[model samples]
Target: MCGIVGYIGKNEIKEILLNGLKELEYRGYDSAGIAVLQDRELSTFKAVGKIINLENKLKDFSTQGFGIGIGHTRWATHGKPTEANAHPHIAEFSNVVHNGIIENYQEIKEMLQAKGHHFLSQTDTEVIVHLFEENLKNCDDSFKAFKKTIDTIKGAYAILLISKKDSTKIFYAKNGSPLIIARGEGGIYFASSDAPLIGLAQEVVYLEDGDIGFMQEGDFDKLQNIQPLNINKSFAQKDGYRYFMEKEIYEQHSVLLETMMGRVSEDRIALENLDRDFFEGIESITICACGTSYHSAMVGKYLLERFAKIRVNVVIASEFRYADFVIKENELFITISQSGETADTLEALKLVKKHHLKTLAICNVDNSSIVRESDRVILTRVGIEKGVASTKAFASQVLVLWMLGVFIAQEKKLINAQEIKEQAQAMLKATKATKVDSKLHERIKRLSKRYLHGHGFFFIGRDVFFPLALEGALKLKEISYLHAEGYASGEMKHGPIALADSHLFTIALMPEHLLFEKIKSNIEELSARDATICVISSQECEVADDMIFIPKASSYMEEFFSMMVALQILALEIAIKLGNDVDMPRNLAKSVTVE
Candidate 1:
C-alpha cells in the first residue's frame, strides 16, 4: 500500500505535493517521491526512506508553479524499498504514481521490454507508464489513453498520470484502491487518504472502482466506464486534531453517538438501514477479516451470539478462503474491513458469493467495493485514520458491531430501545472518562520488563468481552510479539487454563455488570495458578494486582471504551519496551490492499 496525493492548484505545485506527502507518510515509510510538470516535461525527485529523506534531496532541486503533480509514500510490494523502487515512476513521455499492486507486472514488463520500452525502477508502477505510453500512441485523447491503459491493467491500482505534452491536465484511475478528489480554493486536489486535504476542502467526491478522474487548471470531472458520473460535493469535517489518529480515537465517541444517534425510544430499539428479515432468515454468521479488522470480527461474533442469540463464527480472511466449510444460502456471512479493498477479505467475499449466502459488510468507507458486493452494508462513519497501525478505526468498528448486536437483539425482540440508549450513553460517558494518561510513556517504560510473566494472556468477559479478549490478545501479539491468547471467562477451564502458571499474565476484561464476579473468579483462578493478574475492569471492581480501572458504565458498552484505553496503553508500552515499530510493524501495511 502507498499514500498518493495529486494537485492542480494555484499554489506552487511542489510545495503542496511535498507537504501532502508529509501528512500521508504514515501509510508507508519505505520511500517517497514526487512528480511535477514544468517546462513541457515531468520533473521528478525520489529517495528510499522516510519522506524526510526525500525532502533532504529536494533542498536544492526546483520544480514550481501551478501545474499538475503527484506524490507517493510507498510500502514495497513489487520491489524492495530502494531508490530504484520509488514512485513518481517516470518514462520519457509520462509520469505515474500508484497506490496498489500490479499483480501481473512481470509478464507485462517483459512484453514492454521486448517492444523496446526501456525501464528504470523495479516497480510494477513502471509497467503502467509503459502501458500508458503504448495506449497514448493509439488513443485520440488523454482520458481515453488513461482508460485504455486501465483496461490493460491486471490488478489493483489507483494511479495518477501527468504527461509532458499535457502539463495543464492530469489523469487518474481507481480499481480496488482508494482515491478521492476535492475542490479547493485554487483548484482540485486528490489523495489516497483523506486527511491531507481535511482542512483544505470540506466537500469531496470519491472515485469508485473503474472510475477515472481528470483535472485541468480550474475544473475536474469523473468518468465511469468512459461515461461521465455526476460529481457531488459531500462535506467531510476534521473535528480539529493535529493528527488524524488522535482524532479517529476520539471519534469513537461520535461512532457511539451516531450508532445510537437518532430514533428508537420504544420498548424495541430501532436500527436504521438494517434489514430485520435478513437476520431472521439467517441461522449462522461467519465474520471474516484480516489484521485489526479481524479482531473486530472476533468482537462482533461475541456480541452477536451473546445478545442476539445467534451462532457466530469468526475466521481470518486468508484462512477462510481455503477452508472447506459449507456455506448455506440461509447463513449470513459478514466481512469487516476498514479499507474495503483488503486483498484477502475481498477474495473471501468472492468465495462467500459463490455460496449464495446473504452477505453483509461492516466498513468505515461507504460505497466501497466490499460494501457494493455485499447484500447489506453497515457504514462505520469513523473518519480518516492516517496512522498505519489502527487505533480509532478499530475502536469505531467494535462500537458499531456492538450496536449491530443490540439492534439484532431488539429486532429479534431480545432487548429494548431503553437498554440500547442506556448502553450508548454509558459508552459516551466512558469516552469522556477515557483519559490518555499523559504520563503513559514513563509508566509504560517501567511496566515493560514486568510483562514477561504473561507467557500467554487470557482475556475474559461475558457479554462483549469474548471478542474484546481476542482483540486484546491480538494487540499484544501484533506489536509486542507476545504469544497471547483470549477466551471467554467461563471457557478458560476448557483448555486454556493448562497454560496458566506463575509466568502467565491474565487480562480480565471485568466490566461492572452481571458477569463481574464470574470474570473476577477467572482472574482469581489464574492468580491461584500463580499467574500475574492485570484486570481491565470498571472503577467499581477493586482488584489488587495491576488493576487498570475504567469508568463505570452499562454492561452492554463499557467493554469497548475500557478495551480501547487499556489496549492503547498496553500496545504502546509493549512496543516501546520491545523496541518494535509501534506505528509500522514488520511486514504489516495499514491497508492490506494486496492479496
Candidate 2:
C-alpha cells in the first residue's frame, strides 16, 4: 500500500501537500516524493527514505507560487525502495503518483520500449506516466488520453496525474484501491484515505471503482461527476495526543461504551442483522480472519463455545479458503475484519457463500465488500482507526463477540435473564474501571530498554488470554520490529520452551482466574530456564522481573478488557522507547487489499 495526496488550491501547494503526506504517513513510509506544476513546468522531487527525507530535499527547491501539486509515500511493491523508484515518476508530458500494483506493467513496459520510450527507474508506476504520454500523442484531448491510458493498464490502482500541457488541473482515477476527494474553503484535496483530509474538509466524495475525474484551481464546488459520501466525522482528530494510536489506546473506555450503546441492556442484546430463530438452529460456528482480527476471532471461539455450548473453530482466512473443508448445513460462517475488505477474508466469505452456507460479518467499515456479501452483519463502531496497528477496533470486536455470546447463552436457556442483566452491568462497570496510569507507562518504558536488544520475546497466556497474548506479541513485533512469539501456557513445554534463555524475554498474562495457578507454574518453568519474565496481572507475582498490575474487574470478561488495554499501552511504549515508527511500521501497510 502507498499513500497519495493531491491538491488544487489557492493556498501554498507545497506546504499543503507536505502536511497531507505527514497525515497519511501511517499508510506508507518506504519513500516519498512530490510533483508540483509551476510556470507551465512540472517539477519533481523524490527521496528514498521517510517523508522527512522528502521534506528535507524540498528545502533546496523553490515552489512558492505552485498552485497545484501531487505527492506520494510509497510502500515499494514493484521495486526496491530507492530515490529512482520513489513516486512522482515523470515523463515528457506528465508526472504521476500511484498506489496499488499494475499487474500488466511488464507487458506495457515492453510495448512502450518498442515505441522508443526510455525508462530510468525500475517501477511499475513509471509505466503509467509514459503510457499517458503515448496516449496523448494519438489523442489530442487530455481526458481522452487519460481514459486510454487507464484502459491499457490492468490492475488495482489509485492514480494522480499532472500534465505539463495542462498545469492548472489535476487528473485522477481509481480502480480497486481507495481514493477520496474533498473540497475545503480554499481548494480541492485528494488522498488515499480520509486521514489526510480530517480537518481540511467536513464532507468528502469517495471515488468508487473505475471512477475518473479532474480538479481545477478555484473550482472547488463543482463535483457533480462523483457522489458525496456519508461518513461519521465525529472522532477524526487526535484529541491532544501526539499519535492516533496513543489516542485510540486511551479511548478504549469510550470505545466500549459506543460498542454497547443502545444495543445491550440488562436482559436483552440486539444484533441488528441476526435472526434469533436462525441462531437457535445453528449447530457449529466457524470464524475466519487474519492478523489482529484473527486473534479477536480466537477469543470469539472461546466465548461462543464456553457460553453457548457450541463447537467453534477459528481459521486464518488466507489458509481457510485453500483448505479442503466442508461447510455443513447447520454451520454458520463468520468473518472478522477491521477494514471489511481484507482480500483473503473476503475470498473465504465467497467460498462459504458458494456452498449456500449462512454467513455473518463482524467488521468496522459499513459498505466494505465483506459486509455486502454477508447474510448478516454486525458493525464495530470504533470510528475511523487511522493507525496501522489497531487499538479500538480490537476492543470493539471483543465486546461485540462477548455480547453475541451472552445473547446465544440466553437463547439456549443456559443463562437466565437476570444473569444476563448482571453480566451486562458487570461489563459496563469494567468499562468504567479501565484506566492506563501514567506511572505504568513510565515503568514499561524502563523495562523496554532492557529488552530492546534481546534476541527475541515470548508471550504466554491461558484460555481467552491466550489470544490476547498473541495480539500482544503481534503489536510488539509489528511496530517495535522485535521477534516475538505467543503460546498457550501449557503448549510452552512442547517446543517453545527450547528457545527459552536469558537472552529471551517473556511476557505472561496471568489474570486471577481459574487457570491462574496453572499459568503461574508455567511462568516458573520459564524463569527456571533463565528467561526474564514480565507479567500483566491483577496481582503482583514474585517470579516476575516486572509486573504490570491492572485494575481488578467484576468478571473475567472485564478483566480481559483491562489486560488488553494494558498490553496495548505496553506495546506502544516499547515502540516509542525503541525509536521505531509506532504509527507506520516498516514493511507493513495499513490495509491488506491484495493477496
Candidate 3:
C-alpha cells in the first residue's frame, strides 16, 4: 500500500505535503516525492527513503505562494525503491501521484510511446499522467480529459492529478484503492486514508469507486458523501509499546469484544447489518480472500461444512478473478479483507458482481470498496489496523467466520437453539482463553532464542489446524525474514520428510480433542526424522523438545482462536530477538493495493 496527499490552498505546500507524508509513515513506504505548482511552474522533488530524506532534499528549495501540490509515499509495486521510481510523475503538463497497481500500464505505455511520448521513470503511475496529457488534445475540457483517462485505465488506483496549464484546480479519481478528500480551512486536501487528514479537517468525504472530479479554490464538485473523522492522532500512535504490532496483539481481547458485541448472543447469531433473507435461498458458499484472510477462509470452509452442513469452496482472490465460475442460483459469494481495499479481493468481488451473484463482504473498515460494492457487509470491528503484518485482523476474521458458520447452520435448521447457545458460550470462552499469560510469554521468549537460529521451519497440522499452520509459517516468513513452510502433517511423509534434519524446526499444533492422537503420531514421525519439535497443546507430549501449553479448549473452534495467539506471540518474540521491525517488515505493506 502507498499513500497519496494533495493540497490546493494558501498554506506552504512544502510543509503541508511533507507533514502529510510523515503522518502516513505507518502505512509503509520506501520512496517519497512531491510536485508543486507555483507561479504556474511545476517543480518536482523526490527521495528514496523516509519522509526525513524528502525534507532534507527540499531544505534549499522554495515554493513561493499559494501553490497546489501532490505528494506520494511509494511502496515500489512496479519498480525498485529509487528516486526514478518515486511518485508525483510528470509528463509535459500533467502530474500524477497514484496508489494501487496499473495492470495495463505496459500496453498503455507502448501506445503512448508510439505517439512519441518519452517516459522518464519505470512505473505504471507514469502512464497515468501521460495519458491525461495525451487525452487533453481530443477532449473539449480538462474535466473530460480526466474522465477519459480514468475510463482508459484498467487497474486499481487512487489518483491525484494536476496540470501546469491550469493552476486553479486539482483533479482526482479512485477505482479500487482508497482516496479521501477533506475540505480544510485553507484549501481542499486528498489522501489515501484519514491518517494525514485527521488534524487538517474534522469532516471528510471518501471518494467513491469510479469517482472522477476536481477541487478548485477550496471547493470542488466531488462531495458525494461526507462523514466525521471519528479517530484522532492518538489512535495512530504506538502508545508505550515500541511497535504497533505488539500493541495490536495485546489489544485482541478488546477487539474480540468489539467484534462479538451485537452479533453474538446466548442463542443466536444476528447480523444487524444484513437482512434475514440474505441466506434464504443459498445452498452453497464461495469465499474469496488473499494472504491471512485466505487462511481464515480455509478454516471457514471447514467450519461451514462441518457445523452448517453446507457445501463451501475457498479460492484465493487472485485466482478467482481469472477462473471461470459455475455460479449456482442459490450460491452466496463472500469476500474477506482486513483493509477492504485489498486489490485482488476487491476486484474479485467486482468480477463476481458481474455474474449477478449475491455477495457478502467481511471487512474491518466501514464503507471500504469491498463493503460498498458487495450486496451485504459484516464489519470485523477491527478499528484502524496500522501494522503491516496483520495480527488482530486475522484473529477477528476467523472469529467472525466461525460465527457466520453458526448463523448459516441456524438458517438451514441444522443447528438447534441449545447448540447455538453452546457455540456462543464456547466463543466467549475461546476469546478469553487466547490471552497470553506472563509465564507462557516468558517461555516463548526463551524458546524463540533457539528458534531464531533455525535453518528453516515447518509448521505442521491437520484438518482445520492446517490453515493455522499456514498462517503461522506466513507470520514467521513475513516478520523474521525466514524461509518457512507450512504443510498438512500427512503430506510430509510423502516427500517433505526428506528435508527434515536437526536444523529443521517443526511447530506442531496438536489439540487435545479432534484427531489429537493422529496429529500426535504425525509429530512423532517428524521427531523420528530428526526434526526439532515445539508442540502447542493442552496435553504433555513425550516427543516434544519444547512445549507451550494452552487451556483444554472444548471445541476445535476454540482451539483455532487460542492457537492463533500462541503462534503470533512466538513470531513476535522471534522477530524482536532478531532486531527486526515486526510492524513494517521489509518489502511488505499493510494492505496489498497491488495484485
Candidate 4:
C-alpha cells in the first residue's frame, strides 16, 4: 500500500528518487523520505508528511551524480503517522524502504533486542534494516544476506534495501504487492505504481512473488534465489488521462474487446467450462470474495441463476470459513479476487480446498497462489489498479463474470447465439458510452453541501442496481465518513420511507428497468418529505432535483457504468468538501497485500 521507489544509474539520484516519489504521491501521501548514497557515504532525508515536505527540506542540498537511492511514502499501519514512524527506516549501516505488512515484526524485534540491537521507531519496516545489518555482519554478500533475512520474515512485502558499503547497487524484492521497474534515459528506475514513470519509459517489468532484482550502474539482473530470472512486458495504450483510474475507466472498451475476443465470432458464444469434465454432474456453484470482488460474486449469483438456471450462492470470504454450509461432492466453488492474495479470501480458499471441493479462481493476476491452487483459473486483463478504491478492476471482473454467464447459458443450449450477441453488443455500447462529463460534475458539486448537511443517506435501486447502490454508498462512507445505507427501491416503502425527511439525501439508481417508474414514485415520496434527490439513470427523470445521465444500456450493464459515475462524483465532491486528500485517503493504501 505504501509507495516504494528506487533509482540506480549515472544521474542525480536525489532528484530522480524525489521526482519519482512525487509522481507516486497518489499511492500514499501521509509521509515521505529518501535515502541516497553519495561518495561512499549514506545521506538520508525524512519528512513526517507529504512529498512537498521532503522537497522543501532538500531545497539547499546538491542533487548530483549519485548512482543509487530509495524513496518511500508511508501509510501507517503499526504506528501513528509521526516523524518517528515515517519510512526510509535506517539502522546503523543499512537503509530500507518497505511496503506491505510484517506479521511477526514484534517477535523479530524481541529477538534482535536480545542480541543488543536497539530500536528507534515503532514501525514494522524498521525491523528490516536492523535485520539486514545483522545479516551483513554475518554474511559476505549483501544480496545473500537479504535473502537470508527474508527467509525469517512472515507476511507480504515489496522491499528496497540499500547499504553504505554498496553505494552503487539497489536490491528489491516483492511478494503479493505490486512493484514495477523501468529502464530510463538516466538509469534503471522502480516505483510502486506505474503512473510515476509513465512518460519516463515505455518498457516496464513487473516483479511477481519470489522474484528479486539487483540493480547497479546501467545494468541489472533479476533472480530467484541465486539463479537469473526471465521477465516479460505486456504493452498497453494509455491514451491520455491524468490518473490510472481515469485511463482504466476509459479502457473499458478495450477490456470488452478482450472479453469478446474469441467468444462472439459470428453469433455463437460458447461456454467451455461447463462442458468440461469438472461440471459434468456438478449440482451447484459457490462463490466467495471480499470488497469489490464480493459484489462481482453477487452479480455472478444473479447471472448464473437467471441465465443458466443453476443453483449458486454468494458468500463473503470473511464469513464463509466460519459458517457451516452444506457442500456436495460435485458442487463447484469459484473464488474471485483482484490481487488473488486477499488474506480472508485466501483463507476461505484453503478451507474449501481442505474439504476436497472443486475450485476455480477468477483473478486478475495470473500464476497467483489462488490460480496455482485452483483446479481452473480465469484471468482478468484490468492491468494495474493504482487507486485504493477499485474502479476498472471491478468493471473487468463484472465483464468476465457476465461472459461466463453467457458461455454457460449457451453451453446448456438454454440461450441462442442471437440472444447472447445482443447482450454482448449492449455491453460494448455501454462501455463506449460510460462517460462522466462536465454536466455531471456541476450537478455533483451543487449537491455536495446538501449531502454533507443530511443526517444520513439512503440509496435505493432495483435488480442489479441493488449492488450498485450498495457500492455507491460504500464509496461515500468508506472515505467520506458519511452515514449511509442502501436498499432495493421497492423495499423503500417497507421501512426506509420512515426515515425520509428534509434531512435525508436520497440517491436513487433508476436504470432502464421495468421497475424504473416504481423507483420514480419512491423518489417522489422522498421529495414530498422534503428530502433532496440525486438520480443516476439513463435520462433525466421527473423526480430528480439533480440528474446524471449516461448512454442507454441493458439494466444489467447499467450497474457497472452507473456505479462508476456515482463513485467518481462522490470521490471528487467529498474530497473538496471534507478538505481531505482525494487521491490518497487517510489510512487507505492502493493494495491490501497483507493480513
- State the C-alpha lDDT per candidate: 0.73, 0.84, 0.87, 0.74
Question: Pick by lDDT: which candidate is best?
Answer: 3
lDDT of 4 by residue, 73-167 (tens): 88778888887788798899789999888889999999999999998789898899999889888888888988888888887788999888677
- lDDT, candidate 2, 121-225, per-residue tens: 999989999999998888878988888999889987889999987888899998767778888776788988776786777557777678887778655567644
Q: What is the lDDT, from 0 to 100, of the residue 426 in candidate 4?
A: 62
Per-residue lDDT of model 1, residues 468-521, tens digit only = 677777767766777887788888788888887777777777776657677787
- Candidate 3 achieves a global lDDT of 0.87
Report the alpha-carbon TM-score of model 1 versus the true structure: 0.83
* Model 4 spans with C-alpha error above 4 angstroms: 137-144, 179-186, 193-208, 211-266, 270-282, 321-333, 337-387, 436-449, 490-498, 517-530, 538-567, 570-580
User: What are the models' TM-scores?
Assistant: 0.83, 0.89, 0.94, 0.83
- Backbone clash numbers for all candidates listed: 3, 0, 0, 1
Which candidate leads the pack in TM-score? Answer: 3
lDDT of 3 by residue, 127-209 (tens): 99999889998876998998989999997889999998777789988887899888767678888887888778777888887
Candidate 1 Cα deviation (angstroms), residue 437: 7.9
* Candidate 2 clashes between residue pairs 3 or more apart in a chain or in different chains: none
Cα lDDT for residue 554, candidate 1: 57
lDDT of 4 at 4: 83
lDDT of 1 at 508: 76
